[model samples]
Target: MNVADDDDPPPIVVPEVTVTAGGAVTEGAGAVFTVAAEPAPDAPLSVNVTVGQDGDFGASTGSRTVTVGTGGTATLTVATVDDDADERDGSLSVTVDSGDGYTVSSGHASATVNVADDDDPPPIVVPEVSVADASIVEGEMGALSPLEFRVALSEASEQDVTVRYVIRSGTATDGLDYWGGTGQVTIGAGRTSGLIGMNVKDDILWEGDETLTVELTDADGAVIADGRATGTIIDDDD
Candidate 1:
């Protein structure tokens, strides 16, 4: 019988295996598996790798296989289909089987794919304006009363309106500056009635017959409407 030395131990064998995580990928983006391994100096070693879907990977499966030679790495790209509109979160695994000489050291990794959308609209345009009103008084100090008039709007609009009034006096030949006021008004959609009032100042009262013109304008200073009225002011001395 041959006697074996008690101190002799079997040579330690380190199995050659491959490990890797799929490259950068988006929620909806596709990816493949890769292998890292050790190869013999001259003898070629073959490695087979498989990829499997895991976690939020929902209903999708990958079973692709690839072969790698000694001192070489193999990449097995698994075709992937993404049906998600939003970003998807999940994990995948890779298994490497090296015939006999190696054991898989690292055969698992994680993957992610992203998805997105882009489109939107403009704001609503509103209507706006300016207005002018004029009047003549027939009284002395403290005797004039307020006068009112209606300026008809051409079209009915829901937009908030601003009116500017320029009251002018005199004939069609000579223009005279008179009193006026500015204000804001809202016309309900399709409603047309608008009223403007002015207080006749005793100091600005005109004696005898007079003619006045009122100009109505929009917010942009564009003339939208106008009116002319004649009034007779009685002289206090008469």
Candidate 2:
């Protein structure tokens, strides 16, 4: 009756399986993966895979199981996606799923970005103004050229100012009268000095003191500063 079975129980049959995983990923980011498996020749098989944090796995082939032929190999490609938003500072991570007879390996990469402010204020300075060589002699005939004096200004400004010079003969029966021309001068901002000249003519030569007055005016024509110079016109007979 079936004479005691022998020969290692007719060589027990076993199934062979293989799995491979791969995909793109980022550090501190999320990703998805797909897994595939191959079964031993003429044997039934199944594949199960797991994903790491921020990781996902899915199958693309119609089925997760693959039938293998005699002495043949099976292959499967996994798809992964990263959705992490916190890694904006610049870091990346990639992960893979290991199932069946497969090995898993992970890697990371990174980049950097910077931000800054670019606004600043301009420097400040004080405004100043003054006159140089403020005095001049009278009737001396070029003894004191009015053009030699000047007005100085510091820093730019829109303020309007004028310089004027006048000469009046001493109180005499024959007071001298002459066209001194325009005695007005304008001072430009940031300018070291501005020049002004004067001309005088005498109808009668006198032997008394003559007065030369220099005045500075504001935009409203109001006197702001005044200087005077005096000298005597000697008679030629002396």
Candidate 3:
């Protein structure tokens, strides 16, 4: 015959816990967190969980209790708050809290959820710059003629815009008919137009009316639209 031994039952072992995110999280969108246990818990386990966010993230539940069934895995939906304010990308964290029936893993106890900003940034726009043609009359005897050309922009800029102008010979000769050279014209901030000056030499010669070209290129803070303009030198000695 066998007698029953007077002894206590074996101690219950707790399951190790780990937290992981299901997918991506973004503003105006929600996400899920999976709490898993190793070895498939024999009985239901109650685990405490804490959620946190920072930067541009929205609101979320602070702390709650989750149940892990015998299947060893449980999931919870984490709600995200939405806002219209433009912001940068944020982060979300879910941590497994120490509880009675569960043990937190040293490496997998917490999980990070990257939250993306849904609000769009302002659009980038650059104004277009253009130049207009003008004519100057050659004065009799020895005199100087002022040929002023108009350079304009499509819209006013917050900063100064620099436009490069190069003189090209068309029907006129450089240094003989007019001051032909390359230079830059700067349109000041909040201004829409600027003037480019060219000096035409006056001489008592029978030279006919001639034309020259001014080309705009390499404009900073703006785009060149009407890049080329014609300058006419009216002959007064003819």
Candidate 4:
């Protein structure tokens, strides 16, 4: 792109400067460059843009003082600094390399910036809980699919926790052998496991094997996974 015509009598009017970029940003986030001080009207000129790095994606190449206003365009910005080391996407190299009246043309001078990588975010897991045990056979009759106590998390629940349970009496007796409550169990968001719903009753009279106890008291965001759970109701007779 060569443009210099005022009837070509004014020494050819040469003022070439080129660079452009935008898209692919992250890492203290900041990227934008479109410095084009070509040979147009020949009025405003002043360029000082030098930034070049190949260690890959920022280590140098950042400086600016462009004012080609009058439609010649002038905008340069590239900034990134934040590392925890874990990368595989980086690039940087912008030139107008040196400035003084400007004269950098042979293919728009220079430009290349495509960066995106900000690693280090994953650490917050506190969990240790387990509750699971059940067996039912009370001559089936009404509601018996309940008796499934299992709340486990040895480690994995970095957020969202509401575990609170109670139902004790190891010798069974709460309407018979199952169907006792004291609520709340929602362990989600990077969860580890959760489930507690007891219900078992279809009796006439014959109590043989019965034991009940499910305990895991308190947790409003995580930190109550120490353990306790027992459920068994077996007595199907005539």
Candidate 5:
């Protein structure tokens, strides 16, 4: 009983790993993928590749091993990490990882690369607030002189530049000749200039040179440019 019958062994074709993605990549610049394999796998296949990213983009994931010979196609380079922040612009994925010979195509497995966002967003200052004009000398008889008014800032603001003053009455006379009313002046954080003090009340009678008007009126980050200033009250009783 030995009827020679031996000849039946030729059916082992497992190759269906697809993933192709390349275009739009600027963060450190790197994205090129193609790990195909459809019907060309007679002896060199390997396969196992993964690279991912989807948001905030730092880009660069792992998983390697891609041969795909028999002239099927194989090239995968994915790297992108140029983060300084200013985020927004992400998308990068190329996967075909199953293992052993390959077979993972549900519709091209997975592929997408479009990360673009070079990083740029920082610029917006807004600073300009001025008010200067002064002269003070009115003392004798309960004297209280102090009159200083010079609040400027054309540029030099990282932040903190609040100015909103008011002391109207060009002929002097706020609480009865002078006493700076309603105020707010910060100007600090790189600073440009700041000084606003007013207190002059010397009653002896000789009211000769009198004037008072300091108005800046509202300013947060700053932008009131040369509001208004004039304080002079020099009448040394003579």
Candidate 6:
């Protein structure tokens, strides 16, 4: 198409080389940020990435250069500093400065680098001690058996532990429904389990079901995960 001197068919328009913004990083850590250009430039594209000194965390990395290859892309590393002190999180600005022959793409103009505090995580606390479950059978009207109430720990303790156990009142009575199944249960040193049993009474009652709930009373040395457990008595007389 031909045109007047003032309106000569507009010269062929070429897409200006463009670059986008970068990314964030943490304190005392290293992170790589990338900037991308549209069409490859005829020469190497050097982008000035300005990192304003916002705080101690982000000040570690100041003004840096990103060299875009003929392929139209480059990466810059942002190093952080972890000042092992209790401080609030900080941040810095990383902006793509307007260069010689490139345009800062929309939204690729700037980005933020967050500097997180370096604090040691709290120690993990778990249930170190626990108790074992117990089961017993009811004999005749008056019979005593090992209604073993076992006490245990997740791992063995360094020294012997004497945990007290008692036949706590439950759906079944202590004297009326069962016998002595309570007292100090001794766990030997470096042992995970300790046992204490009680005599369960079988009062030949055709009742439905009776329960003896055994519990640990003394937790002097170790912690208690499950301090209580129930023992069931089945009626045999039909």
- Candidate 1: worst-modelled 10 consecutive residues by lDDT: 112-121
Worst 10 residues of 3 by lDDT: 52-61
Model 3 agreement with the true structure over 43-82: per-residue lDDT tens digits: 8888898988866565665898889999999997777778
lDDT of 1 at 167: 46
Rate residue 129 of model 2 by lDDT.
Answer: 47
In order, the Cα lDDT scores of the candidates are 0.47, 0.36, 0.86, 0.72, 0.83, 0.67
Better of 2 and 3 by TM-score: 3
Poorest lDDT segment (10 consecutive residues) of candidate 5: 55-64
Q: For model 6, how many clashes?
A: 2
Tens-place lDDT digits, model 4, residues 74-157 = 777777776777677676657775566667777867777777677755665566666777666664546564667778777676
lDDT of 6 by residue, 1-238 (tens): 9875776685543324343334555678765556777777667877777766466764545566778878877766667767666667777666787776677766667766666777766554332555666665667435665566666777776677778777776677878766765578667777888776777776657776777777777765677778878777665666
The candidate maximizing lDDT is 3
lDDT of 5 by residue, 1-238 (tens): 8798698888887888898898878877888888889888877889887777887665657777879888888888777878788878888887887988678999888899888888788778788888899888888335787888889898899878889898888888888778777888898989899998878888778779999888889988988978998888888887
User: What are the TM-scores, per candidate, against the unseen true structure?
Assistant: 0.33, 0.31, 0.60, 0.38, 0.42, 0.43
Best by TM-score: 3
Clash count per candidate? 16, 10, 0, 3, 0, 2
Question: At residue 96, what lDDT does model 5 achieve?
Answer: 84
- Give me the runs in candidate 1 sitting further than 4 Å from their true place: 1-15, 40-44, 55-64, 106-238
Candidate 5, after superposition: displacement of residue 192 in Å?
15
Q: For candidate 1, lDDT tens digit of each residue in 112-190? A: 3222211122344443332334344434336544445565556556553445544445442121222444453444456
Off by over 4 Å in 3: 1-5, 23-30, 38-46, 52-61, 79-91, 113-124, 132-150, 156-162, 168-173, 183-213, 217-221, 228-238
C-alpha lDDT (0 to 100) for residue 195 of candidate 6: 72
Candidate 4 lDDT at 92 equals 67
Question: What is candidate 6's CA lDDT for residue 33?
Answer: 58
Q: What is the TM-score (0 to 1) of candidate 1?
A: 0.33
